[model samples]
Target: MIAHSVDDPLYYLHNFRQVLLWVEQRYADLLDPHELAFMQAFAGLDAPAQALMVRMVMRKGELFRSDRLEYTEIGDTCSALQSLEALGWVREPEQLSLEQLFALLRKDELASGFAGLLSRPRAAKSDLLSQLQALAPAPRPLSEWFAQAPVRIVQWCLQPLCDRMRLLFFGNLYQDWSEFVLADLGLLRFEQVPFSPGSRALQQRSEVDLALALHQCAERLEQGERPGSIVQALAGWHSDNPWLARRHGRLLFALGQQCERLGEWDLALAVYAQSSHAQARIRQVRVLERSERWQQAHALAVQLAEAPANPLEVQALQRVLPRLVRKLGGPAQPRRRARPAPVIELELPREHAALGVEEAVRQHLAQAGGEVHYVENTLFNSLFGLLCWDAIFAPVPGAFFNPFQAAPQDLHDCDFQARRAAQFDACLGRLDDGTHHQAILDRYAAKQGLQSPFVFWPMLSDALLTQALACLPAAHLKHCFLRLLQDIRNNRAGMPDLIQFWPEQGLYRMVEVKGPGDRLQDNQLRWLEFCAEHGLPVAVCHVRWSEAA
Candidate 1:
């Protein structure tokens, strides 16, 4: 748990110190000489200096005006910054681009700074920036831009080093210093998994570099860099680490997608062929088909059909293969149809339209029978999360690295369940012995609001919990849970929109509501089929709104 508090003036400083200590202890070997030196020098700084540094590091941009750096805790910011400057951690930038200067100065300041240079001084900030940019002035120091200005813009030179420390601490660049504050404030809570000594995400220094490289590549892609160029940059990059390897695959997959969108089918095919992402092969087949390579597409589709990776793959192949065979001049195979679910045709009044189709159906159903809740995917997932909390949070090496993780590092990996097969089996054993009810209820009561990948705390109330546990049969739950374990990432969603529970009769039925002109999605269809196969009560509720009487 986070020990820092908002009441403390130096709470941010304490959080920053905690990160430095954590990375220094766990990732000492991975740290470069510069990082080590920075950590050492940072520790030697006084509290005010440290607090000021933390403030700068946590802020959005590297450049900050000295006046804006004011803090009651860090009295006399300039005096504190002197120590940072001595260490070359923070310094006045040599030059600021037009954009940087524009960002630093407000509209009035910009007007004052370049009085005669501006055509329309009173114009909006954006227009003024455009007008200034048209002049194409060379980058210069802030003193040159605003000679009479009192405040100076100091750039945090050690931002990259600080970012590296943050990456090591969090195992990702996306999560930043705010996680500490959010956790401290109880806005976000993580499960307390006992991390092993060898639980760090990146075991080697090269892996750290690889993670950063992958992040940069992703950023480049997002910035609309050419897909080919980004792919070229990643040409020889590889990682033995499963996590890093997964990141690499995802990057390639994204590049492939971008290539497809740009009408570069050949490049997309090449990228997809090289990518290890689960969806890459199917994409490759699609690209082949699109490029009029029918034979190749057919062959690949056949291979996928024979050994599909997951149910989603199987579902996709069923659609692709028949078309491919037809294109290859083979007899068109009959499309396999999804099993039919019981249907509830609802012509609800327009008066209830504002409540949405699902809610309207839920209300109509409640009038006819028992309680109805618009749970969608939450109810069963929450149940599974509660029942199998122990297995999911097991402190396996490489599973957990930091205390801030909401789920394991490898939660969506293919071998996530395989890695904890024994633990999952034991958790499932409770269902067979009828102990699942007590176990789920106990976990719900004890672990309420604590983070779990599967649990949706806001959706699971006492009434819903008690009703679900009582009404949902143990055998049916075992089947659903097993299916969830089969492919957690895909199977967790696509559940029916609402579940109707009859507490008095110990009965329940799930309803997938579809408004007018809406059809069931592939995932929803898959779930409905699964329910039908296991003899679980589920129905498709198609709603059509009617005029009020």
Candidate 2:
């Protein structure tokens, strides 16, 4: 489950009980009496009501309008709302006076769509207030206000608990909807996993050749005539006699994909046509259709549908051929042939240059330091690895623990936040007691099934961990975790690019390497400020523009 698509819904929901139990056991001491009662009440609710509470935590304030509660498929929300109110966990907003209602209405402009509701002339505010107040029920006494024990208890039990849970399932708690969808979940675990010699070779071939092609000839490709120099370099090769071998072919496909991304269909078609994969042919049919060569496209579609190279190709053919056949009636043409086309000059996006920046900085920083972890987030990730695991997987159901996934349950009912205070307090205690680092190392090393990204033992030397722990004390580390929980959506990046550690002298300095004219982003500024406040050693080293090229 750890290695599967991080987007898998089951991967997260299945861990519900485990996540709950893990925190309960680990952070038992942090729960005060009221908080304990609130958690017990939470556990006793019907699944839908429990899920409704979990969903409410991601939203601001405990109060939600009846309509704002989402994912209605989970269960009867009205019933859940009733259960919550009966338990004294939620409040029904007061039915107020017309004047009060009108005052609330003015919080936003009467929207264009709703202006009709207030189109007629209205009574004066003073008269309306008097009239509405007389008919309104008398205001409740202070005893009703004092009767909100459930509200008080849940706030203590759920806020920190959910925040911690949000950190586990989503390292960035306040991330907007899109960020959650597009997020690279592996960052919490591994961004740079150990690659095999073959994969490394392929990766090197892909990134370097593409970088070199764009860096060296990109300007000329954009300014020059048709057949960008990069594509022209491979112009002589064909599907049957592809002179561009494996590594070069890898680079070729990457450039074609780049052209396709930049909306250069002609260049993409020209480039992909030289590759042997059926996908290249499948892609070309669309380009042909775009160019109005229906007969040629239909022929190729038929060819592919009859004998698709892979399962993906078969699916692709099925999706395209129905429309393609309608175009086939236009003309009869030679079967099993693709149109010959020329590649055009291609432009690179701004980020294309950044591909080479890491290598450039790495080479420059290679000198002087005894060893550089380029530690960035990895160090912090490893330090908090075990706690983060508890956040997501919640390993409470002892015998049911699967090497693959957490115990499955209704996603909405995953009580992510209840034990938050205790678990985090335990993390701070373990780190201070000098047992935290070893525990992370011991568990990660012993469990072959473990895939948590925070286990930095494999990446860093033990001496480095000793130095990192010394530099990152428990209080400072806790402050950082809380900040991450608050800003994970936007603060994932902006860590200093490199750190040079001199183990021989037991010294290290966090360095932000900027390639000329680059300024620190907002998130980076926050981190730098945090470091400055804590007296941690850090520096900003801007690479001279003269050396940039």
Candidate 3:
């Protein structure tokens, strides 16, 4: 009945028959031919034992004690049943009568001879098959091994197999080796699926603005376009507005990465500086370190390390700190001694000569107000202003040449001219506010291109909100914020600067509305330094009511 079907039930029945043959081999020496035949049929069986064997053979596969029959029925007759159950098979046995046992014993002393056969060392596969042929009237050893072996092994041993790599791992067989083959094949299959765009976007979005920028830069690469100008523009705008800065920063970082891949060191450093995203920034710095720009990379690493504690900030710092320290420790650095300060007279834009940071910024609301254009000179201008105010000052140390110090002759450098032209084209390609943002995100996802900073401002603002809120806990602050919003929505109160205090330590925090010009002003810098020195938390808030300024 078992042999008639191809299912597991038949498979196990065939397997049990082989175990019976191996058992017979163990008692071969003690058996007279006639005695062997009687015992082989039903050695110790009573009428019940004969009936049970008939039932076992009649069923499809192996059976287990306690599967249907209880311990009381099979009892001692199926002593090996428990072991077989653990080996993934079932069992049933019928009790043998005393007369049957006597008849079986007179026929063959099988178990005694079987013990001798078991004492011999197991033969190798090819040798064992040869030995099986010599042992006549016994079931073939090769067929028995085939029946008892695991299905996977049986298939491989009996069938021819080939692999593309021409890697013959299985030709050298040891126990459990076939399992290794299956595991390797499974892993190879798993790796064949292509990466999805949504998953790539999700994975990259630690800093949304930056991620988007990288996405754009990657798209540009795919399209065979240059990303450096977009990167520099973003870096130029970062400090004045973090939101916009972050998007450009991301783009620059992505571009810098491509530059690094192309062996453009100076370009990569510039890109790293513009990326507002912490992860991209870290990656950029690592590129700097790899290029052996140790001092610059170290300075950047320190700023990243000291960035306010958020998950991304903390993780970025942790990842690079050990490597940064190791690089710093490797060589003695030649310190450039401090130089005498540059005496620079302050010259304001002719339009706002007398206005301070606050007043200059307030002018943006006026009809004649000129928005500040971030130029290479603007950075030096801001630095020069800060120095004059004594809020913070650094002497322009003696150096052979400041790369940032523009020279009339250097303007003739074709590379620089090309860069400027590319930036101009990028700026001119700006999209309308709504259309541009989705375009930027789509381009970023495809790793193809970037949007102009004007069009990218919305994404930047979102990054700022995310970046700022991540610094404060919502539990104590959110409820108060919502209440203020509710009051404003119903026209019950005017929007007010937020100021909160905790009585326990007399700790106070204040938020003040300011324009970008005010935040960048000398007085704001003074106030910020004062607050920092006094260990107070003060937030300078820049509110934008319009999508475009």
Q: Top lDDT: which candidate number?
A: 1
Ten-residue stretch with the least lDDT total in model 2: 407-416
What is the C-alpha local distance difference test score of each model? 0.87, 0.50, 0.35
**lDDT (tens digit, per residue) of candidate 3 on 324-387:** 6677785444432322212212223544534533344334322332221212112212211211
TM-score of each: 0.90, 0.33, 0.21
- For candidate 1, lDDT tens digit of each residue in 1-549? 465778888888888888888788888888889888888888899998999999998999999988899998789888898988998888999999999988888888898778799999999999999999999999988778777865678999988788788878777788778776666655677788875556666888888888898998998999999999998898888777877887788889999999989989999999988888878988988999988999999898888888888888888889888888888788979988878998988887888889887888888999997989999999999999999999999987577767777888788877788889999999999999999999998998899889899999998888999999889999999999999988888899999999999999999999999998998888998998899889999999888888766
Task: Tell me the spans in candidate 1 whose CA falls farther than 4 Å from its real position.
Answer: 1-3, 7-9, 106-151, 326-333, 461-463, 502-506
Task: Give lDDT for model 3.
Answer: 0.35
Per-candidate clash tally = 0, 10, 24
lDDT of 2 by residue, 343-368 (tens): 11222333534655544555455664
**Cα lDDT for residue 190, candidate 2:** 27
Give the Cα error of residue 388 in candidate 2, in Å: 4.5
Ranking by TM-score: 1, 2, 3
User: Model 2 scores what on Cα lDDT?
Assistant: 0.50
